[model samples]
Every structure is written in C-alpha cells, then in structure tokens.
Target: MEKTFTEEQRNFKELAIEFARRELNPGSRERERRGEFSEAGWQKCAAFGIPGITMPQEYGGLGLDTMTCIATMEGLGYACRDSGLIFSLNSHIWTCESPINKFGSESQKRKYLPGLISGSLKGGHAMTEPDAGSDAFSMRCRAEKKGSHYVLNGSKTFITNAPIADLLLVFAVTDKGKGFAGVSAFIVERGFPGFSTGSALEMMGLKTCPLGEVFLQDCEVPEENRLGQEGAGAAIFNSEMEWERSCLFAAHLGAMEKILESCIAYARERRQFGKAIGKNQSVSHKIADMKVRIELSRLMLHKVAGLKGAGKRAPLESAMAKLFISESYVQIATDALQIHGAYGYSAEYEFERNLRDAIAGKIYSGTSEIQRNIIATFLGL
Candidate 1:
C-alpha cells in the first residue's frame, strides 16, 4: 500500500536515509561482530535529532508528529544495517525518554531532557528483573519511603543500555499489598549512591546494545524525582509499552525491505545451472513471498501510526503490528539466507547477521506468544 505522506514527512525520510547511509551503514557489521557500542554514532544521531524526533522543541527535540517519526525511522532502517544501534535508540527514546517527557516535572525535564536529546546522556529503562521476564510486574524490588527520600533496593536484569546509561527509569514496589498498583517510577541517575550496573550480558543479536543488570542497594532518590504519582509505575510502564510496541519495529520494517532488495539482486545476478537463479521458479517464488510480507507488514505499521496520530487507543492494532512485523522479519531473513545458499551461512556475509538480529524482534517489546495472547483477549476470548 502506498502512503500519502506530507512533504515535510517525505523530507524527513530523505534526511534520515542520507544520515543512515553516511553514519550508520559503514562498520555496522564490524561493530556488531565486536560487540562494540558506537558512542560516536550515538552522538551523530543525536546531532541529527534522532533521539528527539517525537519530543517537543522546548525540551531539545524536533517535535515531529507520529507519522513523521515513523517515516524517518523506516528510512533509517532501510539505509542502516546496525540493528543493535537502532534497537538501543528505540529503547532509549520510547521506554526512557518518553516517560520522562510525559511524567517528569518541569525541573526534571529541564535537568535531563536536554542532555538526553543531545546524546550527551544516555538513558535506560529498568523494569525487567531476574524473576520477571514476561511477568514484568512481578518484580521483587522494593522502594521504602523515608522522609524526603525513598530508599530503593532491587536489581533489574535484561536492562538495555544499563552499562552506559547516564539515567535510568526504574520501577519498584512501594506497597506490595496493592500488587501492580503498588509500583512507582523514579528517575535514577548513574552516579547516585549505591546505584551500580552489573556486567553486560551476551545475547544472540543486538550484542552491542548493552543489556545488563542495574542494582540499587539502598539507593536514595529525592521525592521530587518520582516520575508520576505514587503507585503509578505500572500505568506509566503500560503507556510506554503501548507506544513502544507500536513503533519499535519501524526499523525492522525497513530492514525487511532492504533484505528483499538484496535477495532480489542476488537472485538476478547469481548463476545457477547455467542460468541466473531468478530464472528458477523456486527462487523467484521466495523473492515474491518476501515482497508480499514486506508490503503486508508496512500496511499494518501504517495503520498503527495512523491510529496513534489520531489519538485513538491502539493496543490491539499495535500488538498485531508488532507480532506480524517481527515474524515477517524472521521469515524474510530466513528466505534471504536461503537465497544466498551456502554464502548466507557464513559470517562473512551480512545475511547471517540479519537473521540473528531478526530472531530477537520476535522476543523483545513483547513476545510473539504474548502478542497473540493480547490479540486473543481483545477479541473477547
């Protein structure tokens, strides 16, 4: 489906593509292989206003609309091969930056948003705990209120950008008796006393994204640092997820298009049995299926964007988009690998890396199974 984007949106996409080609495309594979986080790349992206795409200009952001942001991200995915970097950026903006923008007080925003938007300060979300993976709300961490400050004692695992994060949006239980509602969100700075990051954890893909544990050993945060009202952590978290699940896959959608182009180019150029592989029906059909998936995923993503821009609740649409786009990415990667035959299996080619990275999409944001459950529940199951 062809989208009718405004001239400004189109311009944003072009700018994003040019930026990705110049900045992110080169050395992406090497960085992924070495598990090296690109501080330079982050700075470049910040200069390009990527971290502040959806933020208001008053707080050092571009303040682009949802559709423009989606278009720009899609362009970035199309031109950039650094899936890890893209994932890290999304986690920072959606999970960390958005919460602070929406819930932070005037002083908090003044203190953090500028640095965050300028890439001088990297942020992370700390919600997932060792015991809470799919059940993120079942965390055992506690924040005890004492006079003017809250003493936090907990450890969060699988935290993206933990090792390099300057600021973290952490959630802890303030009153366990209230279950999910008992949780609260706080802006914890890196140098806060008793706040520390654990060693980075190795992962299948997004290796350079720096997943790790954030430990709070009686970490004290002023009452003013609380993100929202007391016991509003779960609500804030869910709201952030709604935005995250809807748009986090924007880059992956572009990646699917990139893989499709690569597969098609390979099929037409590679000789097999005295003829190009594109001459073979099997090879041609795989390419066709990849195109189909890319188009379908794009349509779903566009629908989600439209819903969000219109201020409508898109829990169902976002879940469907996330599940479909993630699974489609994995399929496209697999097909691209198969099209490359033996070469695809080798680390020398980018197809294998794409496959490895694609696999993570199915698990993060929300697992495919979890998305399915959400869809089923929404359908009155």
Candidate 2:
C-alpha cells in the first residue's frame, strides 16, 4: 500500500491524521455522550478542506482524485475518536456532494456546490423510505409534475443529516408504470414548502451525526431543481452507492488499524500471571488476526479507489469491499473488546464505543447481506 500512493497523497494522509488529532479529537467523548452535533467541528473540517477533497477546484474544492479522498478519510478515522463526526462527513461527501458534482446542471452546480463544499450548507439525500430500505427501488414517495414545478409527497426515514441539513437530493416516483426508471431525483431545500424534518433519531452508534426523518407533503420543488433527466434516479442512486461503498468504508479500515494497535499495546503492557498477556498464544493470535484484517481491508478498499480514480464502474468490486471491510471492522472491534477484558467493555476506554460503531458499518452503505447478494448476482449465480 505504501507504493500505491504518490508523495502528495501520502502527505495528505499524514496531514489529515495530524489535523484530526489536533482539531477533532477534543471533547469527542463528551459530545458523543450527549449526542451533540458539533457545528464547530463541521466548520473545522470544512476549513481543513475535507468536504472538498474530491470536488472540482472551481467549486471551491481541492479537485483531488478518489484515492486521495480515501486516504484522507482513512487518516481521519485513525486519529479522530469522533466516529460520528467522520460518519456525517462521509454522508455529506459521498451521498450529497458527489451526486451533484456528477449529475447536476451547470446552474445547479454553481448554486449548490460552493456552499456544500465549504460546509456553509449541510447536505444529504432522502431515498430510504420506511418501506424501501434494502429494496430501495420500491419507494412509495411520489413527485407529480405541475407546470413549472413538482409537488413531492412521501416520507424518508433513517435519513442521515435530515435534522440539520440545508438541502437533500430527494428521490420520488414520477411514473409508476416505469418501475425503477420511473423515479426522479430533486435537489430539495429544507425550507421548501410542505417539507419538514422529524426530530433526530437515536441509534446504537453514530449518534452525533443526527439521523432523522424527512417528510415531503405536497412539497413544491422548482423544475430546475430536478437532478439530471427525469427517471434518472436509479442511475444516480447506483452511482452514489458505488462511491459510498468505496470511500465511506475507507474510514473503517483506518479505525480497524487504530483498534488493532491499541489491543497490541494493551497485550504488551498488561501482565497476566508471570508474563505479558501478549506472550500467550491465545492473546497473541487474536492480535495477529486483527493485523490480517487491516491488511486485507486496506487492499480491497484501495482496489475500489484505484478503479474509481481511473473512471471505471466497479459495482462488483465495491460490493465485495464494502462487505469485507464492514464485517472485518466488526470482528476486529469485537476482538479488541475481548482482548482488553473489562476495560474494553467499560466506557472508561473507547473500545466499547468502537464496538457499537462497528456494528453499524455492517448495516449502512448497503448491508453486508445486500453486498453479498450484489456479488452473487455479479458472479451469475
């Protein structure tokens, strides 16, 4: 992996690690305990150029490649204890910013990208309805075209950043007869008439990220706000998912490395009986497994990044990477907790928090089961 990056990319990773330790690490524990969303932290990340890593320079971004984005995210994950902050940042980048950058009209790009990239405007997307999670194409939300505008109706649950988002790329059915092709996406502002957000929903992890519900009841959207052509929602969605599976999971690889290092340190310093616990085959082997997971996760994640950087579609590779990295993080977290014994289970240490966060990795950005199904379909099974 060392040879995989240019000197500039490696420098970006190192800079991100140092910046995260200095800026995002403070008060993270207290913020998580209170489920607080840190506007200050968000701005700090924006100021540090996180939100704009992969965006165009004209849009106030760094205009870097996908590998740099992944590397920077990995560095942030390794150094920053605020997993929820990083989670929210990933959601903002992959789902909202990347979509508009890819598919939005020039006017739309001129309108939204600057604020989004600068973190002056929080953004996300509304796609997963209460009934449409894994079967996301089966969404019931409808958008009826009326003259120069469209009126949107339906609700989205488990929407990341909904409670505090400035805008969302909302998906809704425009033609029931067309199945997945019937759907269209709209760049809906939070203040759009008849659009309201539910209070933030509490979760087992990523609490500070502010997950919630979005309700669009006859919500009026200008025709100009429509993203791409009508019925392009499915394509837009798949594109974003590929990006999410590739880039969002890079943070998990970083977190796994961090946890493995912690466990190794604990195993070496803490003694059992007459020797360090690391001397025991049982403890040492568990640590060894962690190292293997981190290496494998890095390889798979970098493969997806390399593919995307080359302007290639990687549905199969992204699925495999997401599934493997997410599951690996969960297993690694579990092992770290066990290795630390009571300290891992207790809140005094961050291991317990890491475990909670890792479990969510398996569920989001396409669940592990969903990824396996995608892979099987790709194999012609």
Maximum-TM-score candidate: 2
Query: Per-residue alpha-carbon lDDT of model 2 for 1-381, expressed as tens digits?
Result: 355788888898899899999999899999999999989999999999999998999999999899889889889888888899999999999899999999999999999999999999999989999989999989999999999999999999999999999999999999999999999999999889999999999999887899999999999999999999999999999999999998998888878888988988899999989899999999999999989888888888899899988989999999999999989888888889999999889998888888899899898888899999999998898
- Model 1, CA-based lDDT: 0.88
* TM-scores vs. true structure, each candidate: 0.97, 0.99
Candidate 2 lDDT for residue 63 = 93
Error of 1 at 193 (Å): 1.2
Alpha carbon lDDT of each predicted model: 0.88, 0.92
Q: What is the lDDT of residue 16 in candidate 2?
A: 89
Off by over 4 Å in 1: none
Which pairs clash in the backbone of model 1?
none
Q: What TM-score does structure 2 among the candidates reach?
A: 0.99
